[model samples]
Target: MRYEATRSRVEDYFDRTATKTWERLTSDAPVSKIRETVRQGRDQMRERLLARLPSDLTGRRILDAGCGTGMVTEIMAARGAEVVAVDISPQLVEIARSRLTPGLAARVTFHAGDMLSADLGRFDHVLAMDSLIYYHAHDIRNALSVLGERTQENIVFTVAPRTPLLMMMWNAGKLFPRADRSPTMIPHAPKSLSRELEDIGTLADLGRVSKGFYISQALEFRV
Candidate 1:
């Protein structure tokens, strides 16, 4: 099943993020204009999320799991946090490295690794914005384990979910009786959170927030 966002292999999906997603997302006439449009408009809605986070990020060690083009990384840096930005794509890392604001760039360290298997050391905070949705079940579980291992105080992440995929799938089955099987348009109900992301932190509901143009739920856990 392929997601239209980057149209990459589920195995090599992270690698695709290294390409022209930056310029492509920032431009007006980009091919994936619909997705890019929502992301550009994401700034306004990010306020509620920021309010739910620590008051000051000054001197805090942060990990941006899938830093992409450093969009949110800029905000963390502006707040005086030392950021370690990692992405699966070298191209995206290169762009982020070049686009850095000298001061922020100096504070940021970049790495390219698969979140599913990377061994990032613990930090004051760990973040994986809208990136984790690419992972299915086991991958999500593994990511939580890694996050728990690396966070000293908190872990904040977002997932774009609507009801649950099972219900959505049932509805689609009724609507399109003869349609062929295809990729999922959404994710499933999390059977467990407290159990899965346990031991290392205290979990809090960051509540619902917007992503790109879509509504999503943000979850935070303190280590």
Candidate 2:
């Protein structure tokens, strides 16, 4: 119930309230100082996650779970991976599809739905960047388990690490007018998350990126 509620809130925010803002933030358009830092951090984190995958991804199948705006989708497809990019927001998914390069578009499929849906089929590698940050630990574990069951190799994901800076930012976000806030990010301690996910796979730390208000820790679940 909690997960469903959060999912609804997330979909609403991205699909209705902040579609234009997100489209701008993820693009070359100018943004505020804090958002610029976030953009930089997200770019760095995407690179970090990609580095963990095979350099030659020819013929590989990858799931870009919660692939907002499809930045990572285009990159993986360019490397010859069949990319399944899914996001909860149809508006974001449409934006992602519109931005796909000519040839690369053939290698990528865009969907607006639950990333963990069985109908999406299996994958060689799954990358869920900043996608699981809003869920509680138990929900996160369940999500990993569902993804892990169908992923043959690796499931790389990011979480909002429990840090003072992030906590402060989270609290500050709550003070915004209720109608203006996005879904609240739930921070997780690495040790606790590992414990929750131990049965799902062999967990490994892929490192973290903390730039200004954007802080996310990458973890790889080796199945």
Q: Which candidate has the top score in TM-score?
A: 2
Off by over 4 Å in 1: 1-14, 26-33, 116-119, 164-186, 190-202, 210-213
Q: Which stretches of candidate 2 lie over 4 Å from their true place?
A: 171-180
lDDT of 2: 0.91
Model 1 CA lDDT for position 198: 61
Over all chains combined, what TM-score does candidate 2 have? 0.95
lDDT of 2 by residue, 118-223 (tens): 9899999999999999999989888988888898899899999989888888889988997788899998888888888777677888888989867899998875
Quote each prediction's TM-score.
0.72, 0.95
RMSD of 1: 5.4
lDDT (10s digit) by residue, model 1, range 1-223: 3222322432244345326645456334455656754665454335545565576888788888778777767778888888889877777777778777887777788887654344556688777776665455445556676676766766777665555544465468546533343223345343355455566445566666544345565677665
